[model samples]
Target: MDATVFEQIRLMLWDVDGVLTNGDIFISAEGESFKQFNVKDGVAVALLAKHGVKTGVLSGKQSPALSKRCEQLGLDIVMTGIHNKIAALSAICKELSITPKQVAYIGDDVIDLEVMRHVALTFAPADAHMLIKNEADVVTQASGGRGVAREAAEHLLMSRGLSMDEVYKPLMDAWNATVVVQ
Candidate 1:
C-alpha cells in the first residue's frame, strides 16, 4: 500500500514452496519429498548478499533439503515449520534491526497474506494463486521455482543502481572467450 516504504526495502523474505520452488511437492515411493530450485536464483541471492541486502526464507513446511539449500546460499535467516508467518516475520525484522518498511516478502498461498500485509513490498510468481497475486505489488513473468527469484533479484539490484552487465562481465567474458576460435 505504501509505495515509498516499498522503495526502501533492504531485506527480502521468501516462501519456499511457491516462491522459490514450483508449488509441486514430489514425493518418491520412499516418501522423500523433493523440490526443484533454479541455479540462477541461488546466484541472485548470493549477489544480493554481496550487495549488503539480507535474504531469508520462511516456510510453512520444514524440510532438510530447504535447510541445506539455505545454508548453501548463505542466507541470513531461515525459519520453517512456522504456522504464523507474520509472527515469524516480525521476529526476523527485530533480530535484523530492520523496519517493516525495509523488507519485501514473496509468497504464493493464502497463509502468506498476513506476512505480505506487514512488509513494504510483496511479490508473487505468475503462477501464484489469484488471491495471492491480487495482494502482490508485482507478479513476475517467470513461474515459481523457475526464474521468478532471479527476476525479482534483478529488479532489486537495478533499483539500487547496480548494473547487471558490470557485475556479470567476468562470466560473460568467459563465455565469449570459449566461443572464440583461434
Candidate 2:
C-alpha cells in the first residue's frame, strides 16, 4: 500500500501454519498434530527481538507447540485460535499503541488477506496462494516453513540497517570456540 509505511514498521506480526509451516496438516489417529519449523527462522526471530524489533505470531488454529516456541523466543505477543485475524490484528495494534503504518504482517492464505490489507508492509511466501501473493508487498523467495520467515526477517533487518552477520558473529564465534574445546 503505502511505500513510506514500509520504512516505518517497528513491529512484525506473523501467521503460523502457511507462513511458518508448509501448510501441511499432519494428524495422528490420536488427534495429535505436528509441524516443522526452520532453524534459520528461529534465529531470525531471536535476532529481531534482540534488536528491539518486536515480533509475534497469530494463528487461526490453536497449537500448544506454537505457544511453546513463541515463549522460548521471548516474543512480544502471541495470539492463537484466531479465526478472524483482522480483529486480532486490530487488537494487537491497539495494545501496542502503534498505527497500521508501523506494523508489518506476513501471511500466506486467503484468511490473511484482510489483515494484510491493513498493515504497513505485507509479505507472502513464494508458494502462497496467487491472491495472497498478489497482495503482498514482499513475496519471499523461499516457500513457507522452508526459510521464508528468515528471508522476510532478513529483508526487514536490512531495511532497518541491521546486518545479520554482525548480529550473529558473537554466537557463531561462541559455537566455534565450544567445538574446539570439545
Candidate 3:
C-alpha cells in the first residue's frame, strides 16, 4: 500500500481471465474460446513500455487469444496454463535478473494471491472477488476488461513522481515537429 512500493516497480505482471476478460468465457460451436480485451488496457501497456517498464502475462488457463494478445502487445514474458504462478513468477524474475520486489502484480481471483503477495505492489479490479480485493494493495476503480490497466499505469507513474505528460511528451514533440501549415 505504500507509495514507495509502486515507485520500485519495474515489471508489471497480470493474470488473464478475470483481470482481462471480466471472467467470461465464450465458447463457439467448434469449442473455440474467445476473450475481449480493452483497447485502453493495450494503450496502458504501450505507455508502460514507453516509460521503460516491462510487462508480462501469467495465466491459469490456456487460450489462443491470450497468446495473440501478448504477441500484439509485445509482451515476451508470458506463461500460460499455469497452476503454480509463484514458481512461474520466480522463474520470470530470475530470467529478467530482477527480484520479486521489482514486480507489480494485478489479479482478480484467488489463484493470484500467492504471486500478488510476493510482488512489490498488488492491484485488483474493482469487481474482483471480495476476498482477493481485501488482500490487494490497490483496487482499481475500473472493472476488469475496462480501464483497470490504465488506472494502474497512472497510479504507478504518480507514485514515482512521474506524469502521463512525461510519458507522452516525446511523441507529441515528434508529431509537432513533423507538422506543416497547409
Best by TM-score: 3
Which of the two, 1 or 3, has more TM-score?
3
Over 24-143, each residue of candidate 3 has an lDDT whose tens digit, in order, gives 888898664778888777767766766678888899888788788888877758899998999999899999999999998899988888888898888999999988899988899999
Can you tell me which runs of candidate 2 are displaced by over 4 Å? 1-4, 161-182
- Model 2 deviation from native, Cα RMSD in Å: 4.1
CA displacement after TM-score superposition, residue 57 of candidate 3 (Å): 0.6
In the predicted model 2, the residue pairs found to clash are none
lDDT of 1 by residue, 1-182 (tens): 43455458889889999878888787777664667788878866755665567888999988767777887777888898899887888899899898888998889988888888888888899999999999998899988988777788777766656578855554455654432110
Q: How does each model score on lDDT?
A: 0.79, 0.78, 0.82
Cα TM-score of candidate 1:
0.85
**After best superposition, candidate 1 residue 14: deviation in angstroms?**
0.5
Steric overlap count per candidate? 0, 0, 0
Stretches of candidate 3 off by over 4 Å are: 170-182
Worst lDDT 10-window in candidate 2: 173-182
Across 49-68, the per-residue lDDT of candidate 2 in tens digits comes to 55567888988887767777
The top-ranked prediction according to lDDT is 3
Q: How well does candidate 2 match the true structure in TM-score terms?
A: 0.85
